[model samples]
Target: MNKEVKELDLIIIGAGPAGLTAAIYASRAKLNMLLIEDAIVGGQVRSSYTIENYPGFKKVEGGTLADLMQEQAQELGAEIDEFDMVERVQFSDSEKIVETSSYIYKPKAVIISTGAVPRKLPIANEEKYAGKGVHYCAVCDGAMYEGKTVGVVGGGNSALEEALFLSRFAEKVILVRRYDYFKGEKATLDEVLNHPKIEVMYNWDLVDVNGAEFMEKAKIKNTLTGEEKEIVMDAVFGYIGTEPKTKLFKDYINLNPQGYILTDENMRTNIKGVYGAGDVREKAFRQITTAVADGTISALDAEKYIVESKRVK
Candidate 1:
């Protein structure tokens, strides 16, 4: 039997800050809409232990902020469907079809806010030791290394934050950075530097990992002097960077060399009646505030397009 087919004014593809923000606006506009998420509603924001930069809040947990966003959207009458994976999409100027595991949606406008995924470490046996010793989310795997030693790779906000979070569980946290200076916020960098449990390795790169069953040693080399050293750790957490999660829409959308969707200032992709927002789009910066802004612009643009198209019809 065929799946149920429902039509609406718009369909938001992600429930992160971007998609949630769009849903809030769309609901206020009284547009028939649905927000779908394959994973948790909060997206990457849930991973953060503490967030202080977001406006209006002095300090808040990432999960709490996400919950507030989700609450606001729902209160605004936005219909959200969680854990429904979109299987396929067909976009055009007149109509767009989105197919998921449970239903098939035919919406007049579609917003893509799938966001990005963590970049993996490019070291030997990294895949073999993925779950055993190599992990991307310290929040999820840090508890597993209780009273043990773990190494964190990267020099950005995520690396610094994860190191602090891991320090609570690991007896010692080795933060490995290839650059001489950290690139994250000054406050976060300062905290990591001052934390006694965390050891910051400047101008050093993790070249390899060695072990039989689980990871035993991480081989790091000094970038300036070419000196190498091995640190014995139970696990390695990588936060080098992230790549766009555009695999589902890559063939249909115009993407840059780095695989981020290319969009105009209005958040309109090359395809009409379709839009890209948040970390999934090609932008200089990726932040919760920026993603919210992107979602607002796209939803408004999409609403206008739908109204104009109705007149034309």
Candidate 2:
């Protein structure tokens, strides 16, 4: 017997905070929606040990926050299917069909909430010390180094911005850049330059992470001079960049040079029935608050599209 194709009013392609939140709103609106996720629901947020910046909770574990979102979405009647990987998405006329290894889903609208992953430094044994010492988000891990020394890698807005964020906690934050100059917002640059706790070091690259069980030193090399030095730091934060999880959708949508999906203010993509949200969409900021906001906009906009198209379930 042939496998039956599942149908829904809206199909969400990721189950992260954005996707789960979309499911919550879509299901609450009584829309027949299905949320699919192959990995953990929280996405990159799960990697964060703790988060204090998110509103409401002064401090909460990242995994706990993710679980709450997932539970809340399910409690609201959203049919969320875990461990389902979407292979492709094909848009035909006013309908969007998503194909997976196990099932094919045809929905009136599709919301892509697939998130992004942090860019890693190509250094020896870098992966081994990710949580122990090598970290990506300054806001998430900076407090652990309060009154201690840490090194930050990158020169862009995120790097500079995080450097400033880390300055509030870490006694000393050394901004390391491979190039000779910074390439982020001027205001952020001014702040970083003026920050008493920040020291900018250009023309240097992080080449190695040296530690026994946990990280104890960060080895850097001067690109122009070929001189190397090991900094006595507690941890190294990489803000080099992030890679959006849109490889499968690149053929169907417009993307920036860095591969982030292009979407309007309301998270609507160029396609009529397809939308992009969360870290996958190109935006100035990528935070839990912004991602949740994106999900709300996408779900509501998708609802509007479905009604206007007369595809109510």
Candidate 3:
């Protein structure tokens, strides 16, 4: 049997907040749109237990927020296809083609909002103890170490943020960093540094993770003196760094040195009919609020492009 092919006005590559928000805006603009997601629609936000930062709600479940966003987008006539992974993209001057595991879709424009993935430490036994003890996202695994000791690796914004977040649930939190100085924002650094529950271990690197069934201890090394020490912990959270999910567009879009998509202030890429948003784009902040803002901006920019193109013809 031949596969079905559909042509749409806009094809949003992810179903996360950014993608869904874009769909909401594009659908409201009366654009025939399609949203494709490889996994569940929530993206990383679904793993969070409570989101107190998002405006309006003092405290709301992450999954609940995701469900609401999905429902809102679908209610606006956005066609959502779950479990469809975008394998490749072919962009021309006039249109863009997205090839997925199940089918091929041609759209007048495309919005890339694939977001990012966690970065892992090069320490030994890190992968071996993935589910056993070591975790990359505190929001995803913080409940497992409730009232227990946990170690956070890295000194960036995310590391300090995770340390602060973990302190709410964990009994004790140790933050380990290779550099003596932290690269996170001053406010975040000060908050974590002064927090009663968090202890800072400067100039130290995680050398190994030791455990049988789960993580029991972490071997840390002093970067300055080459001294090694072991600390007992119930779990380890790695907040080192994040890598953008832009590999699928490697052949089509221009990327920066860090692999984020290169886009202008309007979220327009070098390609005329293609745009990018969220953490995948070269931006100052990678917060959920920023991603939502980017989605709105990109949708408007895409609408302008579509209207101008139609007028010229």
Candidate 4:
């Protein structure tokens, strides 16, 4: 039997901070919209242990913040479908079609907030010891290495945050950075430097991981000198960077060289009715606050487009 096609004024993909924020605005505007999420509603924010930079709170749990956003959108009459995978999408200036496992949606406009995925460690045997030792999320895997030593790679905000979070569980944390300077915020850098549990290594690179079934030791090399050494560790956490989650929309939308969607200041894409927001779009910064701002702009612009279309009709 063929399922009935659902119709909406706007379709928001990815229920992350950006998508959820869009849903809130769209619902407040009394627009008939649907928010679809393939995995959990919070996206990568759910993986974070704590968030201190977001406004209105000194420190809040990542999962708690996501839940609050989800509740706000739901209370405002936003229709959300969680865990429904988007099988296909057809976008144009006139209309947009989104196909999922549960329903096929035809909406006047679409807002994409698919976000990004963590960049993998570029070291030998890293994939072989993925869950066993090598991990991208410290919040998810830090508990397993309680009282044991772990190594963190990268010098950005993500690496600093993960190292701080891991310190609560791991006995020792060796932070490795290829450059002498840190790319993270000075506030975070201060905390990382002051933390006794963490040992920061500058001008060093992670070369390899060695083990039979799981990771036992990691090879490190000094960038300045031609010296290499191996350090025994229970696990390795990588927070190098992230790549956009735009594989499904790459062919249809205009993307940058790095595969991120290119959108205007108002979040409008090359296609008139389609918009891109959050980490999936090409932008300098990818913070929760910036993503929320993007979501707001995209929702307002999409609302304008939908209203104008109705007026023209």
Using TM-score as the measure, which candidate wins? 4
Model 4: CA > 4 A from native: none
Q: lDDT tens string, model 1, 1-313? A: 6999998889999999999999999999999999999999989998888888999999989999999999999999999999889999877666689999889999989999999999999998899899999999987788999999999999888899899999999999999999889889999998898999999889999998888899999999999999998889889999988998888887788999999999999999989989999999999899999999999999999999889877987
Candidate 3 per-residue lDDT over residues 139-190, each given as its tens digit: 8788888899999998777788789889999999999899989988897789
After TM-score superposition, what is the CA distance of residue 294 in candidate 3 from its true location, in Å?
A: 1.3
CA lDDT, candidate 1, residue 187: 90
lDDT for residue 170 in candidate 3, whole number 0-100: 96
- By lDDT, the best candidate is 4
lDDT of 3: 0.87
Q: Which pairs of residues have clashing backbones in candidate 1?
A: none
Model 2: lDDT to the true structure: 0.86
**Per-residue C-alpha lDDT of model 2 across residues 1-313, encoded as one tens digit per residue:** 4556987789998888899889999989999999998886778777555566689998887789998898899899998888878887787656677988888888989999989888987888788997989988776688899998899999786788778778888899999999988878787799899999999998999988887898989899999999999988888999787899998888788899999999999898888979999999999988899999999999999999888777443
RMSD of every prediction: 1.3, 5.0, 2.4, 1.0
Candidate 4 residue pairs in backbone clash: none
Candidate 2 similarity to native, TM-score: 0.74
- Which scores better on TM-score, 1 or 2? 1
Better structure of 1 and 4 per TM-score? 4
lDDT of 4 by residue, 80-195 (tens): 99988999998878778899876789999999999999999998797799999999999888999999999999989999999999999999999999999999999999999999
Measured with C-alpha atoms, the lDDT of residue 166 in candidate 4 is 95
